[model samples]
Target: MVGNRSCRIAASAGLFVVLAGTAGCGDEPATQIAAGSGTTTTSGAHWQRLPDAPLSPRASSVMVSSGTEVLVIGGQDTAPCPPGADCAPGRITRDGAALDLTTRTWRTIAPAPRPLLGEQAVVIDGVVHVLAQNHGPDGYDKPARLLSYDVATDQWREAAAPANSIGAALTSSGAKLLAYETSHEQGLVPDRILDGGTWRDLPRDPLAPSFDRVMVAVGDERLILFAHELVTNPGADKPSIVQAAEYDLAKQTWRRLPDSEIIGGWYWSHTDGLLVDPSIGGADGGQTGNYGRVYPEGGIFDPRARQWRPLPALPAEPSDDLWQGPATGGPELAIVRGFVLDPGAGKDGRWIRLPQPVRGAAEDPAAAWVGDRLVAFGGTVHTDRKSAFTADTWMWQQ
Candidate 1:
């Protein structure tokens, strides 16, 4: 069982107010706020706290928005490991919840068929497709199942399973769902395209093995695939590389672009453009992981030019804690970490840091564009000794 000390503090008013004596599980207070009743912002963007999600604190949770309703899917609610024991499975959760963006309210939804952790979800034609792992009595080993949830009906049904057990990436082009899986036999990644609810293998050139990749629909006819080199042997020195390619659905062929100067990093795609946060290089000449540094610099990839342009660095924050990027989709706004960067504004785009609702180090919080606002939901927070999942929800608007 997890310790109570790691339990999330329940906010009475649907807002997380930082109390004088109260602190997060971290060394410092979870949030930094000045005395005020109004929301705070550094760049004119406003932050508003929403009702707490009914589900427990979780990380690696998948969230997708269909119209005005946002669905929070299964994630790991980790507990402190017992002394000398390993935390492999770490209390994976099967519960699911939904947040109504218009009313800022939450309601419990049907739970997943099984506990799911580290799964990927995508919304297509108002349905959420969840690619889950198949877990044995021991732990997740292979691609287990594909589940679909209809937002209007609030019901789930099984979809056609992929060919491989491990899902690499999932995205949708218009009404078609494209799922990528790792081929254990050929040591390559293959594409599984969904047609009329069934999955069909798409013919493609052999690609290198990559567990971390991003697929974004450039248009109705082209899908851009960004592949990254993974460090198979953790702690081993490896060079950072990012490859870009575009797949023509009509011609059924892939075209590789010039190698990107940007290293493997997080990507945020909007109707206007794509933003990439490159891995930061440390003093040891090593690339820092996503959580390692607050990389002040980022770049915007122009698909038309097939080139990347530099984006100005973000303003310094009190903590060097890193933020993951391009969370929400909007033509004028971009969210990195918890801050909103408006590149469409004045001469150079400006970065506005928003106040945190649940502090500590939020890792991999799922965010979606809801109407005019961006809703950020559940992520993990790391303390000195232990880590806790969070069910807090916050919204940002200009």
Candidate 2:
């Protein structure tokens, strides 16, 4: 989480074009590192490096596609922590920018009245709606204010705040937006329905106190929220951040799902259900440990069928670095950062390695599928909480 005071954006607004080659995400899925081995090719697609955006690079920002452009919104990065502190405090901004898909040009968008961050963003109709942190951590769990942006007018307007949504998350369901906390952080906060500009509280349901936070994804008429589950053990705390719940958006009701088959596995939502990487190792091989594993041998959940399915084994191993982007579902499903899991490609489905970017992605850039092209904007690398952000935009033209 970022501190309340907004900080200065690192760079000035300018658009510069550059072309470069060679990039690597250490120990990642065959990022074309070796002489011939890393250079594996996929047909009819290549990566085009576009002009750097008009804003300084940042991570955890929300990027959404609005047909004509890709808008990159609020993000945070920390300052260096002292020698003994557990972590450093970061800064969040209300700043935003947009890139024209056709012109490949970048322009600044109006910033929200309040800064925004979190996984609570979803595209509704053609507008992108986000929630702003209404109240700080002042011992009171206050509701977050809802804000919506229009790409056509390049304007932002405030809407009704949801039910105790401070740090709560949201996802889009058809023409409506569903907002709820990942856990019972605000003491049984009710799930919210934002249809049009009005907000309505759904019937409250009891939820676990699993609030450490993860992603919220939309699947069919339901939205699945991923949260951390703290395990109380004798020696040390071995919490798995994979517990989930499903909210039937149509019915406006909540259903607490069962414990994950592979506890602590990384999961993302597919159009059908959830995608899990049940590949974990270390002291607790294939089970819960200190979360010492990174790459996930893909698995999936079928919400309609209420079952889990395993994906084909990855062709190569990946680094300990976490997979950073959102899971994209469709004909070519992208779970891992640079690879697309095409379920119908082969007998068991195969990984299609994307062309490597000169400035590597998957380290927290806002990614979106724009038609046949995949656009990734502004990723950062942090050292001592000192972030080195990249303004470079990479589009995988397929």
Candidate 3:
């Protein structure tokens, strides 16, 4: 998550922040929250613990949909060590398992053919697909492959790898899966889409090389590109030049969206037409943990309407660990701080805060919608020697 303090104050106008305790702008919910981070909701939206995961504790794994179950795939495990304990041997593993949401059980699937350090996964044609990855500091230079898991056959296979996949990303739209690297060679790599079983080049993105850029799938036929264009030449001294653009898939042309006027980073994720910066306040607070955190702030880009709404400042949070994604079970997007309802998704625009995961915080955890219950598991926290690995399973009821 990354951000800047400069935000348009009127971003949340006319939108209701439907939390229990306070109303930032619009009408408040009738249910009076009893505090404790809104952990217990009168509306039956609460957090609960599931059985401990059978899969090994890990982070940065591929968690994607597989028929009626949620599949957990390859990730690296860094065991939290004792104070000053040796932890130079943490390794990435290809192990995987499938969690049958109907029965809430796990069965080990065939391990990936290569190590799994991927952050994105999608299922195409009933097969689970993920990008293969390299590890440590040298991962940027090492070539990466594509891995697919055949659930029915319980087998794994490798495909042509993405060149310079360290900063690559994967997202699915309609029936097509896309892969692209944020940084390649001089600037960026041509965006690729999976056709049949092979990666095919799409059109070249229109933006010039920038310090940072990210693409987010808006809907079935549109992709939104957000970036910080690096300005050169004389008199180009502005601190920030945040940009947003849209690519119409049918026409295959890049059109510029309104300038967000905010610094951008890896924190952007979109769902249901809204691109959200999940965490903002503590992003640059300090070099240490989030003890320097302030209230949350981020920009929300609604490309469909050519609008940008600044996220309303929420109450002070203890930490700034937010995992944002589509709440496939409902019209809302889930962030650890709370859930955001998309006004266009048959619900009123609202923000609902919830309790932090009682379990220790882990970065890059895997979460997916299993019906109305959101299942999340497997992420790690390295305190002293990059040690603690979380095997705990947590679920949220929508």
Which candidate ranks first by TM-score, i.e. highest? 3
Candidate 2 residues lying further than 4 Å off, grouped into runs, are 1-44, 76-91, 134-143, 195-198, 204-220, 223-260, 265-267, 271-298, 319-331, 359-364, 381-387
CA deviation > 4 Å runs, candidate 3:
1-43, 81-89, 136-138, 184-186, 196-198, 232-241, 282-297, 316-331, 336-348, 359-364, 369-372, 380-387
Worst 10 residues of 3 by lDDT: 14-23
lDDT score, candidate 3: 0.57
**After superposition, candidate 1 runs with Cα above 4 Å error:** 1-41, 78-86, 135-137, 182-186, 205-211, 228-239, 266-268, 275-298, 315-333, 343-349, 358-366, 379-390
TM-score of each: 0.72, 0.69, 0.73
Prediction-by-prediction clash tally:
1, 2, 3
Return the TM-score for candidate 2, rounded to 2 decimals: 0.69
Q: Over the stretch 1-398, how does candidate 3's per-residue lDDT look in tens digits?
A: 12222232222111111111111221112121332233424454655556655787776567776768888887777644444454543687888888876677888888788777645776767777777766665876777777777788898888876554556777666677788666433556677777777777777666656546677776788888777664542112233445777877778788877876454334566644567764433222233322222323346677758887665444334232223332222224534334433323332234454444452345456677554456667655545445466676666665
Write down the worst ten-residue block by lDDT for model 2: 3-12
For candidate 2, the lDDT comes to 0.54
Cα deviation in Å at residue 364, candidate 2? 4.3
lDDT of 1 by residue, 280-361 (tens): 2211213433323222223556677787655544444323332344344454565544445555444444555544543344
lDDT of 1 at 316: 47
Each model's RMSD to truth, in Å?
A: 9.1, 8.6, 8.4
